[model samples]
Target: MTAGSHDETLAVLTTACAAVGLDPSGAKPIRLAENALWRLPGGIVARITRAGQHQPTERELRLARWLSAQGLPVVRPLPGIEAPATAAGRPVTFWEELPPHTNGTIPDLATLIRQLHSLPRPDFPVGRLDPFVRIRDRIDAAVTLSDTDRDWLRDRLADIQSAWASLPEGLPECLVHGDAWTGNVACPLAGGPALLMDLERCSVGRPEWDLVSTAVKLTTTGTISKTEYERFCTIYGHDVLNWPGYDTMRAARELRMTTYAAQHAATNPAWRPEAQHRLACLQGHNGPRPWKWMGIV
Candidate 1:
């Protein structure tokens, strides 16, 4: 699909609002990444996906509904709508808009992660947390690669996968928030509690996979302070860096981060340097403190 412009989001929002019987004029953009999100009138949010991505969109809605049924604090789907309504070649789903709040912090993230890790496994089967699969898919989807970069990435993925497979499983497995980084978490209305926001990656997997993103960010990028990192480790009750498989886990996380940037680098020139920087850092070309990363959006 073409890189989505605001027009795509507007079209989806219009269709979604009409399906649910609301005005489309008030829909406002929330974010754009794997999916586009917009806040509509009357406390509803519409998530718009690429055209023909029916199955994955259905899975996301199912996961969100299941999480809500389990009494986990998540953004709920709009009432009285059979979702994934088609709109201008995209699948649009609506969610209950979260009340006014800021993005969550590490502690908030830790709380949500702990809650998800403790919950009983879902009755339905969900995907496993496979970093290699995601990394490989990202590399394949990325259109910005030089032939040399592509070969190097595949070689790196192979090495990481071998390491990932060989390492001992260090954490008890359970349902995990696939991408548990701070940005995906949100502080609740009136400071009730922090809640998980993005359900796209919700699946059964090792808890370590959820923790790896934050740990690696603290290690490779100086974005968050060491104190904050220690606070996360303290709250989560496991310093993932000390775990035996941490190198493999961190490598996998770094690759995912790099390739996510590379996937957008083709059309977003700003992401090219950031992607290359992450790739170089993973290759041990960067040293010590402060490997800055640029955000794509």
Candidate 2:
């Protein structure tokens, strides 16, 4: 789809900038991420998103502040600007922008991911951290799938269900960056080390959950090597067998993503191409079975 009209799209950014006491006119937007990304002068990034109702801005701000306090390399939030409060509207967060990242060396990324997963897993007082459940619920709520797609999803999820059903309750859990893709990671910052962004999906869950997503991201990007995968397993201190549960969740996650893409394709046809690419990947069209993650760890 065509990019939104400059004035029209800028209206949202303008409001967000005004809230932060920044002059939108002076700051030309430069970059955007998967979500609503806007760049301002002086290396500032404003991310306006509307994904979850759980106060993403607040959660992210807390994570950023916590990581910063711990001396972990993390993006710092700009002070003095409260992400706009719109009474249940998703909050927009502003962050201290850094320089462009060098995507070349990824060795640091493996190390950083290990550190992130090392964070103490806190008990969420509100409820259990169940990514699979959330994904399943979304699939149920998503639009009706085509007959062929429905059957494929059903068979895949059934496999996941059987695997999950056999797992004992109270599996060892840890705090993991649920979406630890390469894009979420960046080169070392001049002042510090490499930082991990997109903590919005962070949660306390089985460690394997992080591994599965990380593997999928790496595999899709053709960056993961067998040796590196083994190193990741050793670093995380997890048995390779636990991959079953994670693999199941990963496939389900893809199904949920496909459903979301189906909706977005209505306005952005480009999304359709990406969606097909993901669909083929999930279906194991060009490589080993997607279930390969189940036992390989």
Best model per TM-score: 1
Residue pairs with backbone overlap in model 1: none
Tens-digit lDDT string for candidate 1 (27-83): 677776567888877788888887787776787888888888888888788877766
Q: In model 2, what are the clashing residue pairs, if there are any?
A: none
- The whole-model C-alpha lDDT of candidate 1 against the native structure comes to 0.80
Q: For candidate 2, lDDT tens digit of each residue in 124-166?
A: 3222345554444434433434557645666766776676666
**Per-prediction TM-score:** 0.89, 0.74
Report lDDT (Cα) of residue 87, candidate 2: 21
Lowest lDDT 10-residue stretch of candidate 2: 288-297
lDDT of 2: 0.59
